[model samples]
Target: MAKKVWVERNKDGSWDAFGDDGAHIKFGHGQGLFDPGDLMKLALAGCAALSSQVAVESTLGEGKGATISVDGTYDDELKGFASFKEQIELDASSAGLHNEDVEKFKERVQKHIERSCMVMHTYEHATPVSEEITVKQ
Candidate 1:
């Protein structure tokens, strides 16, 4: 399924993004909202965290607790992201899983998340983006 959003510039030089579900997100340098770079980092982190959570739950059953921390390095010279990292911490004792099982689960989850996360795959594979602009008089 394809999703779409509409964005328009506000009078104050900020921008508003509108989704089909009526959600609104404001963006600008001074709009007190998330800027483009911030949003990009957020998207990446959120995707990784969510994917890791799913992996952990599937491996250890539901109610298992885990924490995922995601970080990305922005390259100012290249004007893009340089690298990304994710740390997944699982509560194996609470889940009552053995050390060997936890290790295996962690390894499997890591591999699956690296391949399954859309945002992470895009970042790693360097997806191409193109834009065209038109002026109406």
Candidate 2:
């Protein structure tokens, strides 16, 4: 099944993105609205959290959560992101993982995220995007 997503301009001169699943997010220029670049960063972070969930919970016990933070540098001349960094924070001490166990757990989660995060994979592989515009009379 194919999911549909679209952006529509608002009466107030802002824009919003909507998904066929009823997801909505405010975009474009405005306070409290996420620009496209912001969304891209968020997507990477969100993907990391999800892809690493199993490894984290398996090591830290169920219901234990992790925070994934993403930062990137944009290259104005290249019109693209120059670099990206992601940090995953979890309380291994609270989970009783010490010494080698903590190190192994971190490695496992990192490997899992690197392999399974589609968003990150796409970004790393430089997926191409094509635009199609429709005009109505």
Top model number, TM-score: 2
Clashing pairs in 2: none
- Model 1 C-alpha lDDT per residue in residues 1-137, reported as the tens digit of each score: 66679899989898999988888888878757888877777777777666677677786678664676667788999988788666767766656777798788888777767877798778778677899999999
User: Per-residue lDDT tens digits of candidate 2, residues 73-121?
Assistant: 9999989898888888988767766688878988999998989999998
Local accuracy by lDDT, each model = 0.77, 0.88
Return the lDDT, model 2, position 106: 82
Lowest lDDT block of 10, candidate 2? 90-99
Clashes of 2: 0
Roughly what TM-score does model 1 have, to 2 decimal places? 0.76
lDDT of 2: 0.88
Give the local distance difference test score of model 1: 0.77
